[model samples]
Every structure is written in C-alpha cells, then in structure tokens.
Target: MSYCVGVDIGGTNTAIGLLDGERVAAKESIPTLAGEGPDSLFDRIAATVRGLLGRCGVPGDAITVGMGVPGFIDQEGGVALNSTNLRWRDVPVVARMRERLGVPVAIDNDVRMYVYGEALLGAGRGVRHVLGVTVGTGLAAALVSDGRLFYGGGSMAGELGHIPLESIPYRCGCGLTGCLETVASATGIARQARDLVERDGRASVLREWFPGEGMPGLTARDVSRAYDEGDAVAIEVLRRTGEQLGRGLAYAVTMYSPDVVLVGGGAAAAGERLLAPVREAMQRLLISDYWERISVVPAALGDEAGVIGSALYGRDAAAR
Candidate 1:
C-alpha cells in the first residue's frame, strides 16, 4: 500500500503526519531546532520519518512527501526563497529532502497548506471561497477559492502581517515601523501587554504573572489567562490588537469576498476574546452587504490542518 507523509515546519516545532489515503495513520513532532540550520533539521526529520514508518509496520514503497514551510517559497523549483521564521534563504529544500528520504517531495507556504486542509476536509469543506488567517508568533493568510489555492503572480500574496499600520510605533522584524504583525500576532500581543505593564506602569495581573524587571518570560498565553481574570490591561490589549487585525482584514474581505474567514494559530486559542472584537471591528469597517454575507470564525482543524493539507497536496503532486 502507498502512503503520503506531511510535514509542517514551524519556528518552534515541526509536526509530521503519515496518511493512508485520507486518514492519518500516524503522527510525530519534534523541536525544529532552527538555530542549528537546515541540514541538521532535515537530518532529524529524515530519521523521524524512518522511525515512524518502522513503528507503524508499513513498507516505505511508493511514498511521497509534502511540506508546509513558513515563508516565501519557489513552488516550481522547490526552494525556500526566504523564511523569516526559519531564518532560511535560497535553500534547496526539495533536493535536500529527496536525498535524505528517497521519495518525491512537494512544498508550499505553510498558511496555504493550512487553508487547503480546511477548505477540503474541515470547516471550509463546502465553502466556495475561504480566507484562512493564522495569528501565531507572526501572522499570515491564504486564500482558497473553489477548492484551489490561489498563488498570485509571484506566490507572495496574503502577506497581511506586513501591511503597514502607521499608528503603531513598534518596529517589525522585517525592519518596518508599525507593521500589523507587531501588534496583532502572538508575539505582538505579548509585546503590547509587556509595554502596557512596563512602559505605561499599568496595574495588571500581568505584572504578577511576570514579576521583576522587564517581565521576563511573558507570553501571549499569560495575557489570555489574565483576560480570564478580568484584568483591565489584558482586556485592553486584546481589544486593541483585535481591532487592528480586523481593520487589516477589512481590506482583504473587500478585495476577496470570501464566504468565511477562518482564524487559527496559538493566539486564536483565545477564541471569542480575540475573534469577537475581530468580527465587531471588521463589520464596523465594512458596508452592510459585505458584513452581512461574510462570517469570520475560528478554524476547525487546529494544528493538524497544515499536516493534512501538505499530505493531500503531495498525493496530488505525485499523481500528476
């Protein structure tokens, strides 16, 4: 029997899944250890894939691999042009993976893979147009129209996180001041919470959560917990962050007019606390026709979406 392997490479962790047709048969995860560079990371991935197949008692014949990478990708060439999260540039990902695993490999932007999974098998199964946004350490989005992923002319579309927001004062890692991700991503939320407690001298449980100078070890999850306790500062931070994100999404909705907008990622786990404001703000900016028809909701597949999408994509690529 043939099998398809899906790999989702993230800045913090890498998730892998093995699929027998449409059903996932096995899964594994490991630290990406990105600082060690691409060669080291791929070595680990190859070993893990071998071990996974061995433990599952499956022969490695007729196997194909699909990968979801975070950043710009050269789809036809199978090269990672640039990945801010992985600190990768001009890496020959397909050639290296094929050498290590001895199988056909396919790749695409991670967010696009996530949207693909949702569009075909999860929340967006029947939707004609789906807009998927992930608010993790950073933010990005993908569009799936009529069951097909849309890659604009250069395969760099849906970079919503980099849209400039002049009102924001923070400098983005991309070297721009006031980029949307600086205020709307997981890291962005934590940064804003830290600034409020540290710079504004705000009275918040966040201070107690991360005591001492600069509130070392603070994270977006901490802010979400504080929001649960009704911390005024936490509420304000999420509200403002969601408002800005919604504003940015308003333009996307105006342009794409998706049937539904699926929001996923670590920060999205805050659920309604973040999405409520996102919906409110987005609707506030759009006219009745746009607001009335669109639904901004949480993604259904969770973390596995990328893996499933990648595997499915690989299966298709192999067939072609």
Candidate 2:
C-alpha cells in the first residue's frame, strides 16, 4: 500500500508521522531548532522520516511527504515565503524534499491543514461549510466552503485573527495594532491576566502559586488555574477574551455562514472555561435567525490533526 509522510513544523517543535491512507503508521516529534535555520531543520526532519520508515519496515519509494506551516505559502510550488516564527524566507521546501526523499511533496498553511483534517474526519465531517480556529502562540482560521478549503487569491485567505478589532488597541505579534489575535489568543489571555493581576493589586492566587516570580513570567496555564480556583481577575480576563473571539467568529459566520466552527490548539484545552464565554458572546452577536442553527465544537483530532491533515493534502495533491 502506498504511504505518505506528514510533518507539522512549528517554532519550537515539529511533529512527523507516516500515514497509510487515514491510519498513522508511525509518529514522532523533534525540536524544530528553528533558530538554526531551514537547512538543519529540514535535514533533521528528513532523517526522522527515514528512521520512522525503517522502524516501520516501510520502503522510501512507498511513501510521499507533506507539510503544514505558518505564514504565506506558495502552495502550487511548495515554497514557504516568510514565516516569521520559523524565520524562513522563500524556502524551496518541495524541491529540497523531493531531492532527498525521491517522492512528491505538498505544503500549505497549518490551520488550513486543521480545517482539512476536520472536513475529512473530525467535527467538520460531512459538513459543507466549516471554519477552523486555532488559538496558540498565534491565532489563525481556515475556511472550507462547500466541502473545499478556500485558498483566496493570495492563498492567505481565512486569516481571521489578523482581522482588526477597532475597539482593541493592543499591539499584535504581527507588529500591527488592534489585530484580533492580540486579545483573543493564548498568549494574549496570559498577557491580560498578568496585567490585571499587577494593576489590581488584588491578592492573586497566582502570587501564592509562584512567590517572587516576575508577573510577566505567568503563563496561560497559570491563568487557567487561577480561573479554576475562581479568581475574579482571571475570570474577567478570559471572559473578555471569549467576547473578542466571539466577535471575530460572528463576523466570519455572517460572511460565510459556515455550518460549524471547530476550535483547536493549546488554548482550546481550557475547554468550558473558554468555550462557555465565547459561546455566550457568539450567541449575543449572532443574528437570531442564524444563532440557533450554527454550532461550535472543539477539535476531535487533537494533536494528530496536523499530520493527518497534511497527509490528506498530499494524497489529493499527488492525485492531481
């Protein structure tokens, strides 16, 4: 049986897997060491794939490879143009991989893979319209309209997080002010919590949780714990975050009227602590005619979405 390799490259870590159709035959991770540049990163990934195939008793000729990354991508050519986190600029991903692996390769945006995974096997299964929201080191969205992932003119469509929220003044990681991501991402949530804790001078459970630690050192999980313990500040911070997320979702739904919205990534781990508020805000923002029918669900694929989605994309691309 023909097989495919899927790699999800991130700023800090990379997930690599082999897929025999939809079943993952092997999976592993390695430090992206992105600071070391693309040559080293790709070399390590290629080595990992070779190792995984060997361990699984699969032949190199039997497999292909696919990757999902952040930032602008030249999907047709498989070139990654300027991913700030990975520090890549116009990297010829496909040519390099093809030279080493002797197989066809495909690449696309990370969240697009998430959407593809959902459309194929997760919450978006059988749905004609799906919107995937990933809240992690950054926020991104992918839209599947009429059962196909929409790649707008520049292939940069569905960047929901980069949408500007006029009301918010916070600077975003993209170096732009007032982007929705600034107020709606995991890091953003942590930032708000830290700011509130420092400004309120309220006896924070976090203060006791980490004595003498600098306020900026607090993370999203720390705030999550505070919320679990009923800290009013943390509660308010997430509440606002959900509201911001809801506003963004509302705009997306109004435009595309997606049948379902799937939330994924690390922040989605907060579960109800995060979804409840976002749902509430979405309810308020959504028009009465559309509110009841639309639904939001967490990603069912979990961490496996990246590899699975990338493999699926590879299959389709190779067929074409």
Give me the candidate number with maximum lDDT: 1
Model 2 stretches with alpha carbons more than 4 Å out: 211-214
Predicted candidate 2: what Cα RMSD to the true structure?
A: 1.6
Worst 10 residues of 1 by lDDT: 55-64
Q: What would the per-residue lDDT of candidate 1 be over residues 1-320, giving only the tens digit for each residue?
A: 35889999999999999988778889999999999999999999998889878988877756789999988999889999999889999999999999998888999989889889888888788899999999988899899998778889899889899998878999988898899999999999999998999999999998987888988889889999999999999999999999999998998899999999999888999899999999999989998899999888899988899999998878777777
Worst 10 residues of 2 by lDDT: 208-217
Clashing pairs in 1: none
Q: Taking the tens digit of each residue's C-alpha lDDT, what string does model 2 give over 1-320?
A: 46888889888889999987778889999999988988888889999999999999998888778899888999987999978889899999988888888888999988898778877888888888888999886788998876577988988788888888988878876788889888788888887876666656766787777565456467777888899999888788888898899899989889888889889988888878888888998999999776787898998999999888888888778877
CA lDDT of each candidate?
0.90, 0.85
